[model samples]
Target: MGCMQKCEMSLGFESGSVTSDQISCSNQEQYTGWYSSWMPTKARLNNQGFGCAWLSKFNDQYQWIQIDLREVGVVSGILTQGRCDADEWITKYSVQYRTMETLNWIYYKDQTGNNRVFYGNSDRSSTVQNLLRPPIVARYIRLLPLGWHTRIAMRMDLLMCMNKCT
Candidate 1:
C-alpha cells in the first residue's frame, strides 16, 4: 500500500485504563485491572522495547510514557497522556522524528524536555500536541519518558500513529 499524502496518526494506551487484559504480555496479568497495580519493568510493542520500569516516591505525583514516530509519511501532529493520577509531573514534551530505519534515533526537533507538556496521572485522560516539524519519510521513532516528582511510575494514555493521509 502507498503511504498517505496527508495523514495524522496517533498510537498510545488509555492512561490507567491499560489493564493486564489490554496489554498482551506474558506478565500482563500481574497487574490485573488496576492502573497503579503494576509498573512496566519491561515493555515492547511492534519492534520497539522499553527496558526500564517506572518508579516513584509519592503516590500523588505524575509521570509520562511517550513515543517518537520516525516520519512514516506526513504527520500533522501527535499527543500523549496518563490517567488515574493528577497532571503534575509532566510539564512538556516533544516528538523527535527521522527517516532512518536503523536503531539510531536523531532529534528531528528541539528536545521538548518538560516545558509545555501535560502530566495527568489518571486512568483515561489524554493530552494532544501539534508537531512543529513537517512529516518526513521515516522508520524509527523513540518514546522518551520524562517528569516525576514522586517515586511512582507513570502509565500511558494513548499512542497515536499518524501516517500520511491517503
Candidate 2:
C-alpha cells in the first residue's frame, strides 16, 4: 500500500477480455456523452482515445469505478495510469467489495483495521501497481479514489491471483 509498483499478470482490462459492460462507475452526474468520449467502457489499461480512456466528471472522494468480476475471484493487485494527453490520474485509492449483491460491502482493511490506502500514479502514462498482501476475494470490486493529480482520470487493470500448476 505504500509503494506504487507493478505486477506481471493482469485481469484483462487492457486486452478488452473483461468487456466494457463489466466496468461501470457511480456519479456520472449529467454529463451525457460529451462528444461520445470518456465512456465507462473505455476505462481500460493502456487505452487512449481522444486523450484518456475515462475522464471522471467529479473531483470528489465518493466517485468510484466498480468492476463486477461476474463471479468471486481473488484480486491480488491493481494497475493504474494517468490520462494519455493530460496530467490527470488517481493518486490514492481505497477498495470496497461484496460477494453477493444483497450483502453489505466490506472495505479492504489494513493491519490497523482502517480502510487500506493504496498509493496511485503521480504522472500520466506511468503504470503504478499495488499488490494486495491479503488479497481480496469478492464478486464486486470498487476502486474509490481518495486522491488525484489533476482529476480522477485513469486507465486500469485488475490483477487476479492465479497459481500455475507445475
Candidate 3:
C-alpha cells in the first residue's frame, strides 16, 4: 500500500462520480431506517454526512458494503478509515469481487491461496490502505469486516489500477 497510493487513481468515490445509487449493502431495503440512518452512500472517504460513515447493525462476517463499477475494470487498492464521530472502525477485513451480478463472488486471495485479510484503521480518523497484488478486474467489489474497533464502521475510497498504455 505504500507505493500503490502514489500510482493508483481514485475510483470516483470522493468526487461523487460513483453515485449513491451504485452503492449498496447486505440486509439493505429489507427494513426501514427505524434502526439506523447510516446509508451505504455515507461510506465515501472523508464523508461528513449525518452518519459520517457506514454503521452496520450486524457486525458479523455476513455484513458487507458493495460498490458497482458499472463495468469490468481493474481495482488496484483500497483506502479505509473509521467513523468520524466515534471510535468505531474496521481493524481487519477481506475483499470479494465479481464481474457480473449473476457470477459467483471470488475472494481476493493471498499468495498462499487463503483469503487476504487486509489490516485497517485503529482509530477513528486515520486512513489505512491495502493494495491488491495482481489487482482485480471486476465490475463489483465488496469489503467485509472480519474484526473491528467497538463495532463495524467505515468510510472508504477505492483505487483504480494505473496501467501503462502500450
Candidate 4:
C-alpha cells in the first residue's frame, strides 16, 4: 500500500537558499501590450503590476513554469505568490521533478495515489507554502498550474536545504 504523504504544517520556508535562476513557461504573451517577455525571472516572489510571469489566457491547458536548480538539492518547501495587483491566484496545481537533465519527470504525489492537484492559494497578497517532510532531492522543479481563479500568473521560490543538497 502506498503511504499517504500529508502536508507538513510545522515545516516553515527557508529563505535565501534557492539556487534556481533559469525559468521557462509554456505560454507567454508577446504582443506590444502590457505583457512583457522579460517579466518572468528567478525572483523569490513577485507582486502584481510588477515582475510576475503572465501566461496567455489559455484556461489551464497544459500551462506551467519550470525552474532549473543547477544542481541537485534537497527541497524542503515551496512558496507561491499570485499577482499582487488583484485577487487572482493559482487554485490548483501540481509539482514535478527530475534529478538529471536527460531523465523523465516524476510527479510529487501523495501516499494514496498521484496527488493530481495541490490547493495552492486563495488571496493574492498571501503566499501559499507547501512543506515537504523528508525532503526530496531534485535538480529541476516544475510548477504545473491545473486551475486558477482568472488567469494563470505566478512567482515561485524553493526552500532549498543547501547543506543536504547533493
lDDT (10s digit) by residue, model 4, range 1-166:
3444333322221233433246666654442355553344523465335544444445555877777777786777878877666566788788889999899988888877765467787877677878776576888878788878787766667676643222
Show how many residue pairs clash in every candidate, following the order shown: 41, 1, 0, 2
Clashing residue pairs in candidate 2 are 5-129
lDDT, candidate 1, equals 0.37
Candidate 3 displacement at residue 53 in angstroms: 0.4
RMSD of each: 8.9, 5.4, 4.1, 6.6
Q: What range of 10 consecutive residues in model 4 has the weakest lDDT sum?
A: 7-16
Error of 1 at 99 (Å): 4.4
Q: Which stretches of candidate 1 lie over 4 Å from their true place?
A: 1-4, 12-73, 86-88, 98-103, 110-126, 145-166
Question: Per-residue lDDT of 66-144 in model 2, one digit per residue for the tens?
Answer: 8999999888888988888888888999999999989998999999999999999989888998988878889999989
- The lDDT of each candidate is 0.37, 0.84, 0.88, 0.64
| TM-score pick, better of 2 and 4 | 2
TM-scores of the candidates in the order shown: 0.42, 0.89, 0.90, 0.75
Judged by TM-score relative to the true structure, which candidate is superior, 2 or 3?
Answer: 3
Candidate 4 stretches with Cα past 4 Å from truth are 1-21, 28-33, 46-49, 53-57, 164-166
Candidate No. with top lDDT: 3
User: How would you encode candidate 3's per-residue C-alpha lDDT over 34-115 as one tens digit per residue?
Assistant: 5356878889898875788988878898999999999898898999999999899999999999999999999999999999
Query: Candidate 3, TM-score vs. the true structure?
Result: 0.90
> Which candidate model has the greater TM-score, 1 or 4?
4
Q: Give the backbone clash total of model 4.
A: 2
